[model samples]
Target: MNEPMDMEAVLERLKEKGLRLTPQRVEVITLLYQLSHPTAEQVYSLMSKKFPYVSQTTVYSTLKMLKDLGLVNELTYGDRSSHFELTQEEHAHFNCKSCGEIYDVDVKDAHQLQYMLHAEQGYQVDFVRLEFYGTCPACAAGGKSEADAGRTKQ
Candidate 1:
């Protein structure tokens, strides 16, 4: 899995991609880096509190741009709203069905799996999605779930 990226490097990438560096965009990136796997609505709510002039449309547009630029990853849930994170490494996800939490899971043999599928099954590999759904530890303990716990597990 990927580590925390340097903001300066991210800015450089933005410049390389010909994306204008704006205050709103910076805040959006910071928020996603700070609060991993946050929904667009969650971002809009917090951004409104910090920068009242920042609109929901701006947040949506910023997220869209970030996704298109591969600076962020969008984690979608079947039963709940989608979440976004700055962790863009090739890792799998674990979704807690009971508590609605998403955990990052690193697949050590992801490349091997792709190779096996392509060589053995004659299936072309494009993108792979690996996610596990189950009850989190805190949910098993009847308490709030900690995102760090999931991160540590991986």
Candidate 2:
């Protein structure tokens, strides 16, 4: 499981980036801190409950800014819409086909693989993304098969 995000650090980073600490931006960031693998629309929907006037554009722009700042990551799996998560230590992702849930997974020797690729293949690795797709524990317990991987959220 991922640790809770440090809101103070996020605010400090925003200040360092010379960005204003607007209410909308704060709400969006707070949502990112709380949600795991939420899409842009999901963020907007939750934020709208508090600030009913909040626009989807605001969510998208805030997410884009955070992505540009390397504070968040957007993931797209199978045929689902993109999901957002806070940038953290190197890790992989597991997508549950039956429930459409995204889970964080620890990757072993991830850095070694990057180093090996750089030393042996002459490739300068920027970052690595490893994703696994299959039925989750609950799905498996329910006797769901990999063919049910077609289930996905927009």
**How well is each residue in 53-114 modelled by candidate 1, as lDDT tens digits?**
98889999999888888877787766567788774667887777776667677779887898
**Backbone clashes per model, in order?**
0, 0
Candidate 2: pairs in clash: none
lDDT of 2 by residue, 1-154 (tens): 4553588988899999899999999999888877767889888988899999999998999999999988888887656789888888878888886777787878787779999999999999998998888878868798655444332332
lDDT (CA) per prediction: 0.77, 0.82
Worst 10 residues of 2 by lDDT: 145-154
What overall lDDT, based on C-alpha atoms, would model 1 receive against the true structure? 0.77
Using TM-score as the measure, the top candidate is 1
Off by over 4 Å in 2: 1-5, 78-80, 143-154
Instruction: Candidate 1: give the clashing pairs.
Output: none
Tell me how far the alpha carbon of residue 95 in candidate 2 is from the true structure, in angstroms, after superposition.
0.7
